[model samples]
Target: EAAKVRLADGQGREIACDGVLLTGQFTPESSLGRQSHLQLDSGSDGPKIDQYGRCSDPAYFAAGNLLRPIETAGWSYREGRRIGSLMALALCNQLPAPHDALTLKYAAPIKLGVPGRLVRGELAGLQHIQLRVSRAVSGTLRVRAQGLDLWSRPVSALPERRLLIPLKELQLPEHLDQLDICID
Candidate 1:
């Protein structure tokens, strides 16, 4: 079976594949929170929350993608578990006021991808990029300014290839707390 979705441009198209995969982007769907008179802050790439996973409203709490856009599934599960514990304590009247430091330290832009490039002379070939994780599950990728890297399993084992192109990390003002990727 096929499915078709009308785009904002009013163009018509249909997918001939048997299955479709959807990716999550940063689009705040906090209408419920807003309608309920809860404080809303769309300043960050994701929803704003204190360390305890509490939203602007003391009674309302949030977790997962609703709070922040994390690429790894492991981080989402951890956040969910933490929020659950906090909610349970709040319900039992055993938890104190929430603290941001106590909340999980989430790494922004969990995934990075680079595109293939060709240069001349010594820099003609592609540079070898490597990611070294400081923690068991955390790491940094070292690559040239412009280079391409793959981030998917073998095609024979996986139907699609996930390519991760490397770009430079930017230094933002101290006031900002999130990472932003600017692709040229």
Candidate 2:
């Protein structure tokens, strides 16, 4: 089982594969907003939006992967809900509250590879890799892995006095040694 990939004229080509999974990249499709004179912030690969889902233009707003590039669908839905609320409040002429983005702290997906022999270990035979996450500080999220401790850390610190957890990531740590293992 072998696969070959080729690129020509900035296009991709694939050949000789028993099974091929084609996935499309997340592309910002703000053409409608652009046509409506909305200012889109293309700072990164995806469209840029404020914490409140407000685009560069006040009249326009965005959400989901189109607004910001995120790997998880859970985050996208949460963003949509937050943006929807902001839009509704704005249209109602009521002083819309500020939007505070939530931090998504989850373990990275496990990678699958060919099976290999385990040499001299407490547990023998096939072994699995796991990710561990814990709370180091009161408001900080730390991620750790097997044989590693706290490689990545994200601060859930918010600027506003009010606490709004757009998603579960904003929730306080459950335990001292709790590892959040999210498959896909």
Q: Across residues 52-99, which tens digit of lDDT does each residue of candidate 1 receive?
A: 456655586776556433334675587578778878767886644533
| Winner by lDDT | 1
lDDT of the candidates, in the order given = 0.39, 0.38
- Model 2 lDDT vs. the true structure? 0.38
TM-score attained by model 1: 0.39
TM-score of each: 0.39, 0.39
Best by TM-score: 1
Query: What number of clashing residue pairs does each candidate have, in the order they appear?
Result: 11, 0
